[model samples]
Target chain A: MTPASLDLRPLFPAIVVAVTGLAVLLAQAFTPKGGRAPAAALSLAGLAGALVAVVVIAGGRGRGAVLATSVAADDFALFFQALILAIGIVAVLLSTSYLRETATDRGEYYALVLFAIVGMLGLVSALELVAVFVALEIMSVAVYALAGLQRDRPESQEAALKYFITGSFSSAFFLYGVALLYGLTGRTSLALIAQGLRAGGIAPAAAAAGVASAGAATALALVATALLLVGFGFKVASVPFHMWAPDAYEGAPTTVTALMAAGVKAAAFGAFLRVFLQALPSLAAHWQPAVAVLAIVTMIIGNLGALAQSNLKRMLAYSSVAHAGYLMTALVAAPGLGTEAILFYLVTYAAVNLGGFGAFAALTRSGREPVTLSDMAGLSERRPLLAAALTVFLVSLTGVPVSGGFVGKFYLFSAAVRAGYAHLAIIGMLMSVVSAYYYLRVVVAMYMEPPVGEDPWSRVGTGAALALTISTTVVLVLGVYPGPLMAWARAAAGSLR
Target chain B: MALFQAILCYVFGALALGAALVMVAQRNPTYSAFALIVTLVSLSAVFGLFGAPFIAALQIIVYAGAIMVLFLFVLMLLNVRTEVRAPGEGRVFKLVAIGLGALLVGEIGSVLVAARPALAGGFDASARQVARLLFDARYLYVFEATSILILASLVGAIALAKRDPSS
Candidate 1:
């Protein structure tokens, strides 16, 4: 398709999110105080409409380079659009009750959530470097605000400041990397860059021999790749760049934390997969080993960090980091079944992490932090359903059989092994064993330990319960019957090239 | 004409550097802010010397004008007292600052010299050309996305900074 005649039919989901975000903002302005329920209802309706649009578009013929070749409407992008929209719906549901309990239930919260989803949808579809950067910034700015949503909490403010500062630093690096890549290949479009590299149009030797020499150009490209890696690394909360994740996750509202752990990480991985596997596949020999090492380090460090955490939020934060490592292993093995593996893992991971956080949100009441291990003491006695749900989630997180996480991990490790990275898979399995300690620790705290004091069995709002139930159902279904989703994921992965 | 441009570039560049030095040297926040304005204005002048008048104007309007004003207002609102440094502390800071500054200058000088052959031709940075390119399909997405980003930031700022009446 020509750029001039770029079709926008595939952008229906993103357009829905953008319009819904603005409508929510306008509604917020017009709605009276204590009308948070209506605003939330409106947001939910908008997300459901977006979800419908995603399904319809996915059923249509997948295409490439929509909106003037800036974004692709391929199945890969559609998969992420659907995943992010689903996650956004659940997050909004969780937020409705949590915000109400905390007395921060303003319409702006829902509006921001919609805007963040717009960013994610755009990010997954963006085919050009400039568009990627813009979408990245859009997502980052919205999340930064969400991280600091609790105005009265000093920890929240600190979280926002730290995330914003570090996030901006990474953006700068990413921008510089884009500049260097453009200089090397004279193109910003991912497909064109790949074509140029494959055709020897931007040969390293030719670049080295030129005025700046082939060495300089090649060096620039390498530096650019490193910078982009750092940028994506920070977003996915990989080991060395993950210092902000624990604090940010711990400080944000539980619902927001769920969104960060599930939606944001998935979106980041979506971008990472597209950029590294689609655009720079020619340079896989250089990047694959580096990424594999990062995966190993991240897996070990994230699990070890979680083992030392007394707070449940902090432990989950570290757990999210460890999961990022697992996903990265798939990326490192991208030439094989890595792409499909990562997609399956992301779907499972999103469901389990969101469900885990949703359970935590259900237990949280206004004006109190019930996140400590002791705070969870005898949780089974207090709230049997929540405890049971949390148990399921934790079990899934530990990759136990009969859960979605197990299937996801099996796919990822087998993909690595099939790709001749059995060592990585071995390390990954060992780390999964190490992770079980912390995941089961929470279960033990809930089931075996006696109550520290009053059970703190506050009522679970309908919205939160719905979110938790949906997440739990997704986890269980994917675990039991992974056929349909695996087929979709494989198709989506095939469309990437 | 080329000779005149070169002279103008050196003058404005030196002024910018001097202003930056003064900004960092000032102990009082207000004075530091004023020095920052000077640096921004001088940088704009340097941009003008490079034949980017539009960017120069934007530098003044956005950075030296609005941003500096905001900085000054925040400084005044906070009313932070001037910090008193211990004798060796300030000395050590100055020494480290000077060393870093020297290293930065050396790096820049080497890069410029090495890249001189590649910089033989200069591209036009006229407003009309920049506008045409920016409005082209290739860049239009980024431009629109940037607007969305700014809007999101505005919403976030208000959401975080505004006080809750219920609280």
Candidate 2:
């Protein structure tokens, strides 16, 4: 665990991303206009390589910290690395046609995507607070720019501004929390901090014997925990901190929104699980109730907000907030099952949400995006195959039987109930039911409502279609045969505990 | 020596506070920028008094030097000819903001008072010691990651600010 014996093997995936991002940037700078295809291909190759590295490393290693104990290259980190890499690849595929059509097929676009994945990988693996903050900024800054990529759009600019301001504000709170934690425990490493807390309850035994009062140290730790919660809650887009999600999701390009919902949320949850379950286990009595309340509020607000949205993007944004709530419920559950539930739900959610956004990206025309519910009215008649795919995604999101979302939610709620939170689980079930109304509304609009005008569907490219097919297949396969993925999740959960 | 250091700390602290107030109250963007620079410089002096010479140097070099220049450049780029004062709208906002600010200040003050008996005298670390700590294995990863963060921000700025010829 010493710094001098740091192993770089666990960092292979992040290195792949960083190197590819730089290469993409250089290629973009040198390449002629309209030659951005190679950049996309290069980015995809890099992500695929990183995914392979994750699988290989996962097979070869035991669970432990690496890079001088700054990062844990455990099954948890490997799982998130694989998930984020898959998300990046899918997002890149989905972005290809959108970029070409919008005349923004610059190499920098792919570079930013690769770089953001690097951040997410680092974030999931980060074992220290400073590392966590650094990785988070690496992701957030890139994403802020990605959100405002379309410089001509006022909404895009506004989304970037709001996201950046709120994101940085939350980061400040997180850093202050880290400072306070260090003050209390005299350690920056989460493991050491936990040991410090367990040894003397709050402050180190030696420090407690000195001038520092245990009460003040405990109070500082509580404040730090609250600040950390606010920072992370904002990242996962829970209620009260979710005002940016709708606008940011609605304004960004569909592919970027897909990455934000699938990749960013998963990465944040990975960190959330580690910091809470592993580092702050002693303070569960203090944090568990606060998290439960947050989960209930997030679910209610997110679903209710979605109910009022006519814009497909806005609705999905709210749905993302609700999904975060569902994941939070899993976190509030008993430790082992809760961890397993989160991993399983995140995988299914990545598939369902990406597929959902991919369908929208597929329908995007040359000069206009498919924003309104009316845009999907005659989708069934125009592009029946896409409409069918959207139906599967929507159905899965609604937690209907024979879909991945249903199984995921079932496990999440059952785990919560087993943890003796039946009331919270009941509220979760009701919210899921409420969520189905909006999800089904989309299906109903596509299949039942008549066309308002001529077909506005653009030609779906091979890349977009390929991404859709993969995500759809994942959702369906996981739904039907959940055994393998659940086993993987369980194994990953074991490493953390 | 301790008395002199204490006096220096109070002087810099007061100067920093006054500069901050001036920065906030100033209507003209250029004047506000100048006031901010003064505040940063004075804060650096306070840091020096606290025996964190490296941080003080960084505060002056990074915050007062590079960041303030960037701020002034942005203000000039935006070129607000006149300060637009919304009389009624700002009043409520200002009041609420001040109320929150006071509450935060009060909380911090109470916490400091509660921990006053436990407060230990500061031990100064030289710049070399600070460097060693930062470059050590425990922080090396984060330090390296910060470089990548800065790199990402640099790339992002260029990507956003650059105009697309196709557009």
Candidate 3:
């Protein structure tokens, strides 16, 4: 076959997920406990296959094409595809031990996880409004079920309920925004929408109408932007729209939380980057100030709210919100940073956050959930390696040296500074300082306090431990030498225009 | 044909908006579920008006007829209506949410005004015309992508609805 004909490889990542999803379902039906190992192995193999496919497709630039106007199977898609697959793999690894301990281990559990990964990959790659919405629904539905996967726990049902209610609400907003934007541009394609806006042939009479009738095309555009932002804000747990996150995160299984923090956050940001940066660039003047305000509120509210939280998951939920603010700052400054900074921050954020959650996942006792800060006391003494891994993750979250979080924050702040939003950068820096206190406090609890009755160290699994170690190692390595990552991020971001 | 199309779009859009308003305003969870069904149905019609006949049909068949029914069935199965008699959250928060809603509406209105100039000829033709446009060589990729999304959704739904084996 010619090289062009041979280049059917890049599309395998999506196909791999589909195939694995089916295999997992089959395993659930036909496989026994001893056979369960094969399901896990198959999932890992599939995820690895997808990740390698992404790398190959990304390497063979210009070989990938948009499946239609609705999906771009290019470097940008591959970058996010790789992130989603990695997060999925880590989640699967973390859950193996947790599930085995609870006797909740089943083939369907892995299958559901594969399905969730399929949704996430679909979300990252989709380019059209309907496509994104469908992908999001698929992802949300699977996760809602996953949240309640622990059927024995009432909290799991509660978390699933709350998430479903809020998620449906957000979906409504997303759909409405899609409708409004379609009304405004008559096309669902972001590129076409942008082109139409740039052409700027709107009649002036439309501007003279009342607030509802403001017939001003910009009014509809602003409404659409606000609606879309609300939907994404809920997903990323930005302040004012983040009330559901803490409760949901606390109630859900730890492995699922890792997926939420890493896969969902990355996918949401991916969609946000694609929609706003590609379609609404011309409306920057209208939306920038609003985003700046949101960034500040999210940062302040997230950090301060986390202060009173005794629940570790809840605190981390709030911290995730705070981080969303920092990422939003990067997004707001996208005009100045040229998109590279936002993409880089997402990658680093995924590594560090997933690492922290994975570490937490390993420390759980059978039939006992990890919720309280006090529950983790003296962890450094009992399980030094896991503690060290968690510490590294926490430090990375606090933007400490030699961690991916540090590099991500540095790029975000620098991007804002370069964008001449010096004030926003300063605010972001101050919030990071506030954030450091909570992350460090976790470290203090681990090292300084007496052990809680019995050490939970022996319960940690090799797979989960491996995930944490690899995540922490990647975070540190990326922090110290980010040139290679920065180059790819720049290339992907440049392709947006 | 133009007048009929305009009327159809308006009726569907209005019905959808009205149902959404009822869903938000209704205090009873059961009533809210009923309103949601109406809203979903209206939205499906709105999709039809936009010329996406297949998607519109799917919206009704899947979202309104099946998904909403499933949601209602779940809600009933939980039998939570009596347990959650009180408002779900604090009154002050609700008020603030309403205020934010107003501001959001105003902002969206402003954006609509700004964007109106470029909307000319955006919807000059019906959904069938658009579908024809979609099948053309240049637009073929999107058709395939949409199919993939549908397939993924099917898999996802099955995965989610499957029972816990350990139970």
Candidate 4:
């Protein structure tokens, strides 16, 4: 509570995001017509600087710092901060061409994206329930608006509306859970709650308070847990709670969708891991079953759901949902391996999704949305490099050899197996197989189908193409040699507070 | 019989449940949104009766005040007047929504009832204690989070309202 005790170093990443966001806004204000490129460059530069700052501050292997009970700057936070910043960088790169083509190339677009990333970083680092809720709102509201940034596009508006309603409802559920939790434990900090729960049986005086004390506090805790689960489930787009994902993904600009699937989901998973693993560990036996069921349902539903989608973005959305299920399986199989598995899967998933979406962004021509599977036909014949890159991305998503997704899934299933949930792993793997069917379907259309008239791949900028190429290469590199990353993941997961 | 206290609890709980039901079944979204606000406010009152006065006040202030206003403004702006015209009309989807809604309600209900044993004596001077804790200890974080929320809102509002430059 002392001002001297407030270690501001832990807040550097968040401050960097905020300052960079402001810089982007100011640059947007000063920039003239046709100056979107410079604005985007500046935003990208700011994000890169923030990324560097986060690394430099949190780069050491130790727990960097803690800002009272509100935030922590440990390996877990640094990992997510890095992931979010990386996603922001890719989003900026994707948006450069996307905005230029759509003729909605406003400097503010990049600024909003940067601001969303700022929120995302805070969401990951926050250690208090209140702080997490506010960070989530900041992130969600920004993305909701960005989804409909192309206001003239009906689909964009529709995406934004659906996302906004569902998101608000989820926020209410999350806050209600927080309230219930506060009532039950008279606290909100995860660390304090964990300590309270473990101090030899719900406090001595609370026990003497008798029957009402036992039932009410326990009931409130359980309700809070369920609400929190639902809230996070919606954010991660798990099945049975994933209706908004496809519409939002398909309707939003591809870059925004990428940000949602990558940055937002990663942050949500971080919160999910932190809350359940930290505050509710004592109730693991009770909640693990619920999570297990959700995992199975999400995997099956997300994969089957993806089976019929023709739109690439919609398919990827379903794939993202299925991936959440897969990740949830790891979370459910919880002898502590769940945490590490989730961190690993999230890093791999971010790279793969960004790569896939980057490829899509590269294919999109001016005045035309290249979302349909048919629209991507004969890509290999027309734009060989882009087609090959997309193939790598899809193959990686399908868990093929030497791709990050493959290693990611391997880590998850292995973690589940280690937790004595081999059956869950089997079911998850089966769902992965089903997901591969849809992800590969896109690949087949890209290679097998004939070109529909003149290909517009020539219109894609070299920088955009380079981004896709780098993403694809990263996917493969991480897949083949994931040892270092896994080591980092293990350390980060262990540091869960 | 402790008539005043028991009667208050029953009355407030009944109002909360009633408003919640109205919120769920109402055809008009604006009306549904309004019903939701009422439910939230009454829930806050219920929390207040339970001695979590701060939570109750926050419930009314945060959810009912800021959140619902935003919801209602969007509803009015978007003119979501007709239930039938609401997006996602597929029968299967509706069925899923209903099923999920029922499950959520059931789960929460069961949990609440199960944990009912833990409730102790209601609020007795904890309001000032909690407030003091929040301000004296948690003020800086709250300030930071509030600033972030405001900035996000400002950016979001502008983004949502801006006209297309190309148009």
Best prediction by DockQ: 2
Candidate 1: true interface contacts recovered? 0.67
Better of 1 and 3 by lDDT: 1
RMSD of each: 2.8, 3.0, 6.6, 6.2
**Candidate scoring better on DockQ of 2 and 4:** 2
Q: TM-score of candidate 1's chain B against its reference?
A: 0.80
Q: Of the native A-B interface contacts, what share survives in model 3?
A: 0.20
Once fitted onto the true fold, the runs of candidate 2 whose alpha carbons sit more than 4 angstroms away are A1-4, A33-37, A62-65, A201-212, A450-452, B1-39, B42-46, B74-84, B89-124
Which residue ranges in model 4 land beyond 4 Å of their true spot? A32-37, A60-62, A199-211, B1-137
Every model's DockQ: 0.51, 0.53, 0.18, 0.34
Over A1-497, each residue of candidate 2 has an lDDT whose tens digit, in order, gives 46547787777889999999988888877877655548888999999999998888887763354777788788889988999999999999998888766656676788888888999999899888889889999999999989888887888888888899999998898889888778777777888878876665455433643426667567667888999999999999998889999999988878889999999999999988888777778788999999999999999999999999999999999999999999999899848998899999999999998999988887777748888888889788888888888999999998888889889988999899999988888998999899889999888989999988777678889999999999989888888889989998998888877
lDDT of 4 by residue, A15-111 (tens): 8777777777877777777455377778778888888888887656435688876888888898899888988887788778877777667766776
Best by lDDT: 2
Please, what are the lDDT tens digits per residue for candidate 3 over residues A1-497?
22233333434677787788777777666765545546777899889988887877777763456654666776677778887898888887888887766566766667667767777787777767777787787678777777876767887778888998998899999899888777766677888878766656142333333323424577788898999989988888898889888888877787888888888888888888888888888888877888888989998999898887988888888888898999988888885363788788888788877777777777766766666778778888888888888888899889987888888889998988888788888998998888888889999998999887866544678898778877887888888999999988887777676
Superposition TM-score, candidate 3 onto the true structure: 0.80
* Every candidate's lDDT: 0.85, 0.86, 0.78, 0.82
Model 1, clash count? 6
